[model samples]
Target: MRQDTEGLLVRLESDKDGILSIDRYGFIQGINPVMAAMLGYGASELEDKPVRLLLPDMDEDLQGDEWRAFFDSRIERHHDHLLEFVSAEGSLIRLDVQMFTGDGLQGGMTLLCRDMTLHLGAQESVFRQREQLSAIYTHATDAILLVDRRGYIENSNPVASELLGLSHRRDGPFFIDDVLRIKNHHDAWVYPFSQALIQERPVVVTDDIQLVLPGRSAIPVSVTASPVRDRSNRITGCVIVLRTTSESRRVSTRLSWHESHDPLTQLANRRQIENEIFRAIDHAHIDDTTHIFLYIDLHNFSVINETCGHGAGDELLRQLGRMLQEEMVNQDVVARIGNDEFAILLWDRQPEAVMDEAERILQRITAFSIPWRNRRLKVGASIGVELINADSTSEIDVLLSAGAACAAAKAAGRNKINYPSPERDSPSRASLSQWTVRISEALDENRFVVYCQPIVPVKAQRDTQHYEVLVRMVDPAGNIISPGKFIPVAETSGLIDDIDRWVFERLFTTLEALPSEVRTGYSFSVNLSGGTISDEKFRDYVVNRFAGSSLEPGLIQFEITETAAVSHFESALAFINALKAYGCAFSLDDFGSGQSSFNYLKQLPVDYLKIDGSFVRRMEVGEVEYSMVSTINHLAHIMGLATIAECVENQSQMALLEEIGVDYVQGFLISTPVPLNTLF
Candidate 1:
């Protein structure tokens, strides 16, 4: 028995686990090297030492004889316990300990210990991750649902219950499709979760998705489903997230409406009318249909705006907009194009029928009145009807023709419909059609020529010669058509910008071809159209031209009409500033022509202000005209801008402009617009 006990002790010393033995007196009788190392001591140091040194809080009942008896009672039986000990590093450590009782002969207790520190740390980390997931799942905003492999609802967030109208008293787990029904825009049922589960990937439904509710109206929603996976990388179920999108859709719809309609009257605005006109022109071309375009100009309306305030005018316009809509058929279109101007598109109508409709609308507008603050407000409309057919060149042409007819009606007398007389208007229409072709041909064949009229200094001797550049087209018959006849046609046909670019390039090329000495002593001003000012491509072209040219930027000036600059104020300002940075100058040509000329003058960074020829022409005849020119010149000087008087046809006009402190004068008297070569 002693030999057997010695063999067992030797084997225990070689064991990987820690081992220790205590005597009846509770002293460490022996300890294996593993157990001594675990306690941060040598085997010899712990031998014969009290076990209470390792376990400081040993129970009083577990001391001396009691401890021996307690351990001996479970002899030949296995027992386990968790014990805590302090290492030499002053750190607390846990151990899984197995104990065995020795017989009376041995009279001691033996313990086997295994370190459990790493296992406990792993378990704690897992517990913390679970808690974080629980919090996120509970507090999510979008409706979230978890499903099983069979598409059964396994779990759901609070939002899911409320959003899907789920009942708290539901008996058991239900299928996802049984609880929620989703449809697409075409009224076809959509099953995003099923798709995700089958395809083992994410599925999204965003195109006009609607969630149908029991006994309630359907609501718009966006849904996404992602497949959930198990440890083996096999799809187990799906996670569905749904978000309501009705409010967002509503906002988008409202923005689209505002883009195409006027806010005050909820009627189509000018841009929408232009689109409709384009469509009408297309229809006319395809079907040889004749449409009527009515340009309605309200006369005597400004009287209400002046006497009763703009509020009354606004109310009147709103009423007029609604009345126009009421008088039109479903296929007909009406739009508000200007302050007191409205346009109506009569689709696919005979000429006689369109004429009759125009007459009726004219009478209705003339008789229309509204009561406002103890007074009845009345206004009249002049309606001009133009025919839209396969012969129509463009929307602008149709609009201009209608506008011209309206002006003629106003000139004839207001409150009537001016039907274009076939006999009188056909030649004008034919001329317009011919001019469209002619302009294109001219641009292609280089039939356009540049002319220059001198702009002479009024007060100072000229250091550099100044000229206002002009353009003329030589027709196939060798006839020079005045700008008054073709410029309007060019403008309406959308060829004005082309003409502008042609003039600029031609002038530049011609001047660059001139003798350097001759060109360096002169400055040229080129006119820019409204369309050109608004065109970004044209702006880039100008910049590139200037960058590539050898001409001096200071000698090249751009002239934009007052109305054109004011109409496209932002584009004009940007264009002007861009060129001005390159050392070029700008002139607000035909100044005092727009109603808000002075208001915009302060904002426009111009080097020159050209008084409108109408004002300059009559400055000699009337005080009002004379004051207009003088006031313009005075204001221009106040803003540090030079003033040029246009249409100085006589010496008297030049003398008057000089008296007004004008800096320059250009007209027939200065020099009839001569050929570019003649200027040398």
Candidate 2:
């Protein structure tokens, strides 16, 4: 372990931030390679040095009541105190320091320091952008065309130049009417600039205001013309804003069907779909025909983008689009509305036919595979269906209903078809919007921490205490925040993998700081998020950690939830095999929670099966639950694997687990989670 520590220290010597320890008397007792480098001193040269060597404002001997007062007021679990230091090059360096008081009252503090140069730089950049917005807004993508009172073009921004097809024209005077072919609601040709200037008010055009191009077809744009005022409030010119509008954003406007298809999938975009819906609604009202709108979303497709690459994700989407086209009739319309999301409009209103098509599409997606770099990747999809008839509301209402149904399906678990009910609450969307900011802020501030929970053997085993590393967040006020409060938020936002990485890095740093007995004696079971399990970069990081660490690989164990493993079986197996090369053990955590747990367990080479805490906590109350625990325990042992019971909160529960041949147990009854410092 000492050998590994030395190697890791050497590897970490180039860290951008500094790390040091300060004694009770404000003496710098020890510093890591990073702090030494930051201060331009050898690691040994900084040992047992007075803190005044770094902080000149401090007295040579900062002891007595002064030191006592500092401890009483300054000691905290988490501190965001800032300090300025003269760097090795004699330049002022501002440092953001997070300090945690060490084990004892008189003990020193461990400081994790980060340089604030880059953060300050980003702030300055934002400030500069805000200050210069007026000068830069003209170059923005929004088209701005300036026309004089005579309806002749006076000036135009670059965006307008592209939109008006004027990029190829030389410098010359142009008339607004000659440039744009504007048709109004009365189906009469009108000049927006002339109208706005004559009326002294804005003249908006949402109808067909198509920009005529040289030797090409016209593209529709929403035109807004307002009189540009001078100092006396006199009309100096008419400013025309030309924005390209999709059929969905248009006000009762329709476009040619072939004009709005997504180029990649040759399927309709949102614009075309909107047009189709409008036509269908009119037809339904007149002919009494009915329809079913299906909103489909691909599950875990983001995993492909995160692991294999976005190119692979796009390819998978294309494949699914082709399959949908093959399964649908000519009357049915499909659109690639958003990323990994599609909408299909079924012409028939029969509930049975609509469901049959939906199921067929689901099956095709489930069985479909994409060729990603020489490997075949799997896919899953969820669907929501909304039936529409002659009595159905507007196109927008039906679209929203279809969306709600799709959301309900995903909430129930992906790869299933669901219909939205009037009473079912949809909180997943709200949770995502509320937690994204908080989770992002937590990550940026490095507010996450690792806590170790003791996992003791049900029977006599090693005296060394094994632990499962759990994650916790340290709020700004220095209070401990539970994982249950933020974990689901992180997972929903695809940020759980980031949190998992933070946990591992923190746990690894703590482990490297411990003595060989305390470090190597304990076996660690770190939780792996499903997102991380599917990420190639995560796999690489884990492999690199093992390559650099001095401890035996067997000492490090990984615990992946059963549901995650089964859902992404191929990816999980590949990840397990990669880490197994380094001798790291694996545990299938939360086992017996899934419908196909045993079936997938037969395929996994896991060393342990951790029974779900729900079963262990409730087994004593229900015979069925108790039988489940016994059956899982026996089956695991039969498969040459040990069992660990979670949430064992009493001696009776522990005794029951031992009687059932469970190998280990973890809960408040045995030990609660403690800081890594205390564990060591």
Q: For all candidates, what are the clash counts?
A: 0, 0
The C-alpha lDDT values of all candidates are 0.79, 0.74
What is the lDDT, from 0 to 100, of the residue 138 in candidate 2?
Answer: 43
> TM-score for each prediction?
0.50, 0.48
Error of 2 at 536 (Å): 1.5
Candidate 2 vs. truth: CA RMSD?
26.9
Q: Tens-digit lDDT track for model 2 on 245-355?
A: 754423222123235667567577877777778777887888888787888888877567656877888778877888888877646788998767899887756756777
What are the runs in model 1 whose C-alpha is more than 4 Å off?
1-291, 295-330, 333-344, 348-384, 388-400, 406-426
> Please, what are the lDDT tens digits per residue for candidate 1 over residues 1-680?
11223434555746567877777678888777888787788789877866766753355556457655434343333243556666666555567665655464275667767777688779779967975786577555567899888999888865676566552334657789987799998889999988998788999889998999888778889999999898999988899988878766445434554566676565678877878888889989999999989999887665577568779988888778888899987468888876678999988898778768888888888878875654568888888888888977677667767877786787577687778777646767656656777889989998888988999999889888888989999898888878887887887556899999999999888877877777887888999998899899999998988888777768789999986786567678889999997788899999887655465678889899999999989988899999999998888889999999999999898888877788999999978998887877
Model 1 earns a TM-score of 0.50
